[model samples]
Target: MSDKAPKPLNLLDYHRPKRLRLKDARIPPLNAESKRCLRNLTAYRPSRPKFPYPQTRSAAVLVALFVGRMGDLYVLLNRRSATLRTYAGDTSLPGGKWDPEDRTIEDTARREAFEEIGLPRDKLKVPLLCILEPFLAARNLIVTPVIVLILDNTLRFPFSLTHSPLFSPPLPRFPTEPELIEVPYHTTNEWTYPGPNDTTLTTRAHRFLTGREAGGIKPVFGLTAAILIHAASIAHARQPDFEVELAPPEGQSREERIAWAIYSSPVFHEAYEAEEIKVDWAKVAKTAGGKGGGRSTRR
Candidate 1:
């Protein structure tokens, strides 16, 4: 091995959010980006293991990303069964408690996803590209977000009218347990990435809400939404077209606020402000004086 230390990234300009895109099939490109960019990614170590209690339960959620039927990217989400004892009927990523049989938290994520949704082991490509910072859900549990990418070629659809990773066999079969059945997976409820012309983009000021009694999607608020937004942003980095706009907005949607909170969480902010993630992504505009790196950034 060469005994050379990597050169540091020059952030004077990288700090500003710019439209970004990578022209490659692989998400998070298997090959290393420029040395500076690659090295900067190393600086971001998600903040966790902060608590000392051994009995405190540890949980993991898979922020599974894949090409959708129309070629656009989509993530998997589920509504909790109304009968479940906790957070029943809430929308969430596929996951659960870390199991002793699992070798790592990532294993917990995959295992739970398999048990809960029947995602075949063959569908998964990269088991883990990176792990985001751990979050404490509204409840007391410590939850970790695991990012997994599906093989672009493995997914197939009946027809190619508009998307990729054809999501045929529309819904996954749930386990026999009635409690698990309460969630009742539906094809219509999955969150759609807002395209450029999406009506939601028109305002950029309003929050997307879920009406519980109306038989709509379970609201994606708080930590879950934050993790998703974070994943979506990173997923596109490998595309030759990904870019961030340089602007800020007054406090608006709960998502921008929550995402900013996680990104600026004491641990994340320290690494970010230091440009450990490469460029100093502008502070979310909602902050008192900082300009948000991305404005109205929709999937």
Candidate 2:
């Protein structure tokens, strides 16, 4: 890898070109299946989560999709290096926390991918499709999923040794008929957090089982699994094969619960404000209306 930084992406190349220079242009024309997936993602409007304070704990993960041998879309995944202390050897999308130099969240994703797997930063190689709504991770970080497509399926690069390109089951088949996921698919566990006036606010944890591997790669679960499920659902135009709703059925929505957590946490506030970022208390009050769990014990 070169010590020289990647060229900052220009605004003109910020997104996928709306129309090609020529209708018959075959500068490597994508197959019909790839085109369909791109169309679905581009048209999706994801719900955005709001907070009163600046999201200094923000991060972005790249959901790089490419057409597989069977003419179906597949998501590229990485196996984290075992040398890392956190989530070591776990399978996850390539991403990291937002950096001060990042001009946009999309740049954060692209930069992380380039650093992790030697993927090119040029939009000509990997084109943006869409970015999904922000997801609240157990760590209190707001994670945004950025979707991109690998233009050349056969293109090769000098990826890190720890960068394993695992092809998820074809998008259409997904969790519905995936041979990779376990039988029960996902299970939910309730977490109780101490709330104001000594009230107990409960949140649910959804964990999916990815079958064991001989190479010591941990199963995908938690935030990574949730992101994949959400992304695949959008790309394939369908819901997961198993139930996704977390219990108790009457509990506060995930976004509302997370907002309340951030709003109520003095520690989170002190850290966020320490960065000298402006706080929007009115929006925070509006979004974090309900009293619920402030944070999750697990990631």
Top candidate on lDDT is: 2
Cα RMSD for predicted model 2: 6.7
C-alpha-based local distance difference test score of model 1: 0.43
Cα lDDT tens digits, model 1, 1-299, are 53332223221111111212233334433323232232333233444321121112457787765544444444666666667787766676778876556556666677777666655444224334466665555444456777655655554323211111112111111211234344532211213222111212111211123324265555565566556545544443332121221133322233343344433345433423333233334533333233446422111
Listed per candidate, the RMSD to the true structure in angstroms reads 15.8, 6.7
Give the 10-residue window scoring lowest on summed lDDT in candidate 1.
10-19
Error of 1 at 234 (Å): 3.9
Q: Candidate 1 regions off by >4 Å? A: 1-56, 122-126, 152-215, 233-299
lDDT of 1 at 134: 59
Report the error of model 1 at residue 113, Å. 0.7
